[model samples]
Target: MGAAAYALWGSFPLYFSALAPAGSVEVLVHRVLWSLLLCAVLLAALRGLGDLRALLADRTRTGWLGLAAVTIAANWGVYIYGVQSGNVIEASLGYFVNPLVTVLLGVLLLRERLRPAQWAAVGVGVVAVGVITVDYGRVPWIALVLALTFGSYGLAKNRVGRGTPALVSLTGETLLLAPFALAALVVLEVAGEGTFTSAGPVHTALLVSTGVATTVPLLLFGAAARRVPLTTIGLLQYLTPVLQLLCGVLLLGEEMPPTRWVGFALVWLALVVLTTDTLRAARRRAALARSAVASAHG
Candidate 1:
């Protein structure tokens, strides 16, 4: 499920490019509105509306949901813009950096402690960013924005992940944002700039299907989270960025300077270190658990 979810997300550039006639904001608005409607229908079918209501009734959880909505919307908008602007490589770079960003956020905001190897990984990530910035002779704002927004979004999701059923949380996010999206669509229509009105049946169908594209991966990810350990999930997160990077370079014909590749290499090194540390920790824990059980039997 995790692989499937990340793989779907990695292929997003191809999907978003079809919505080219529309602005990123327009595409995002449609995504929010259609996704909300889809989620609402699913919740009703599954009789999960009560769960959604319960979340809204809880003020703190609701606040986190709102934050998650804003961050994810921002992430979506930026990614679409990146694809449209032929900055898909930069977008891929952002996702590549996200795991380190997420880990740093945990250490800083959640007061979690990192082992030596994890800290080394974080340091390598920082160096990669520096290298990329130097190569550009300016900060890669596209990458930075995508990484920061998504890292924060991930943090927000973590806060409510265990308690909220994935479907309910998804519904809440869409429901919270749907009004604004609908309003945006109306304004665009009034200004005679809406794609929905001007697009052909094929294009319109693609636009409408955005909801399915958005929801399916999330549902898969939710399922994967339940069955997999965090360490394994963490490693799987790399697949999306790697696929996006390939698509950007090979299919999209995006430019990658040798310097940029160097930066990517460093980030890849960091991920290797981090993954090794996580796997070692998991193995140690499993061994200890087995030992404890053996001692108890004795």
Candidate 2:
């Protein structure tokens, strides 16, 4: 399920690509509004309305959840903008570096100790970022922003616990942003600035599909995250960024310089180290459990 969700998410570039002229901001607005409506209906259908009420009653938790939702929305908006505007390679860089960002966060925020190999991987990432900066003649801000925002979003989510059902919680989040989305739609329409009307049928369908496009995979992802082990999901996360990178280079005709290549290489190295560590830990735990069971049997 995680793989499927990530696959769908990875393929989002195709959907957003067709919506040119509608612009990223416009599409983001629609995504927020439509996603709210869709998730709300689904929640009601699933008899999850009680969960929404429960979430609302806990104002403190709801406030924190709202912050998380907003953070994630910012991450989504930036990512969509990057993809639609032919910056997909940069966007993919974000996800590639995400694991490293999480590691940094752990070190700084959680006071976790890293092994020497982990520190070496982080150093490699720093060098890669320097290479990318030199190649671009500017900091890789978009990629960094995507990474930081998303990393923070994940951290915030951990704090929130199971405050509400996914649908219910996300519904509240969407509704929080709906008014802004509605205003943006109105402003864009009034200014005759939207890409919807001029782009014809295909673009229009894709634009509207952003809502389903956004929500469906998330639902699938939420389901998948629960069913799959963290290690499996951790490995599968790469699929989305890989697809995005391909779309940027092949489909969008974006050029990747040698320095950018080095950056990506370093990021991938960090992920390999992290994922390898996680899998080994899981294996060690399993082996220990087996040994204990064998001793008991003996």
Q: Give per-model CA RMSD.
A: 1.5, 2.1
Regions of candidate 1 where Cα sits further than 4 Å from its true position: none
After TM-score superposition, the amount by which residue 246's alpha carbon in candidate 1 deviates from its true location, in angstroms, is 1.0
Tens digits of lDDT, candidate 1, 1-298: 9999999999998889888798898999999988988999999999999999888998888899999999989999999999999988889999988878888988989999999999999999999999999998988888888988999987887776677888898889988898989898899999989888587888898889999999999999989999998887888898999999999999989889999999999999998998898899999999999999999999
lDDT by residue for model 2 (1-298), tens: 7877999988877777777777778888888887988888899899988888777678787787778878888988898888877888998888888888888998999899987767877787888788788888998888998999899878766666653456777887888788888999999989989877777888777777777988888888889878878788888899999998998888889999877887788778777777777788789999999999999999
lDDT on C-alpha atoms for all candidate structures: 0.90, 0.83
Pairs of colliding residues, candidate 2? none
Candidate 2 stretches greater than 4 Å from native: 162-164, 288-298
Report the number of backbone clashes for model 2: 0
lDDT: worst 10-residue window of model 2:
156-165
- What local lDDT score does residue 239 receive in model 2, on the 0 to 100 scale? 97
